[model samples]
Target: MRKIIVSAAAAALLASGSVAFAAVKHTTGTIKTFDATAMSLVLDDGSSFTLPKTFKDPGLQVGEKVRVSWEMSGKNKVAEAVKIAK
Candidate 1:
C-alpha cells in the first residue's frame, strides 16, 4: 500500500510538471500581415502563427504593434490570444 501511494504521488508530480512546461509563450512585435481568411498573422520579425477561430479580432492591420500568446501545436505555433500593444 505504501509503495502504491508513492507511485501515485510520483505520477501526479510528473503530470503537474508537464502542465507547467506547457505554459503559453508571448511575443510582441508589429503585425506584418493579417489574413482573416487564412486565420493567420505574421510579425515584422517574420514569425508567423496560426490563429484559432475563436481568437478575438482586434481589427488588426498591417504595421500595427501587438502582443500574442501562443503555444506549439504539432509543428506550428498556434495563437491562443492577441491584443494590441500600447
Candidate 2:
C-alpha cells in the first residue's frame, strides 16, 4: 500500500513537470513587436515571448513573417526562431 501511494505521488510530480516543456513547431506570423532589452518577440496572433536563449535567427524585425520553432511556458511561448522563411 505504501509503495502504491509512493508511485502515485511520483506520477503526479512527473505530470506537473511535463507541463513546463512546450512543444516545438513551426509558427508563421508577422512580427508585432520586438523588445531588444527584454529580448522578447511578439507575433501577430497577439501572443508574445521573451526570446528563448535557444533562438538563433537574425534579421528579426517588426512586420516580418517568420517561421519559428518555440516552446510554451504555460500559455506563454518562446521560439528558437529559425529564420524568416520567405
Candidate with best lDDT:
1
Residue 50 lDDT, candidate 2, scale 0-100:
64
- Candidates' lDDT values, in order? 0.94, 0.76
Q: lDDT, candidate 2, residue 9?
A: 100
Q: For residues 1-86, what per-residue lDDT tens digits would candidate 2 score against the true structure?
A: 99999999999999988775545767778899977777788889987776776555487788988776777666777666647868
Tens-place lDDT digits, model 1, residues 29-50: 9999999999999999999999
Off by over 4 Å in 2: 1-22, 54-57
**Candidate 1 segments whose C-alpha is farther than 4 A from its true place:** none
Itemize residue pairs with steric clashes in candidate 2. Answer: none
Report the number of the highest-TM-score candidate.
Answer: 1
The residue-level lDDT of candidate 2 at 39 comes to 78
Please give the RMSD to the true structure for each candidate, in Å. Answer: 1.3, 4.0
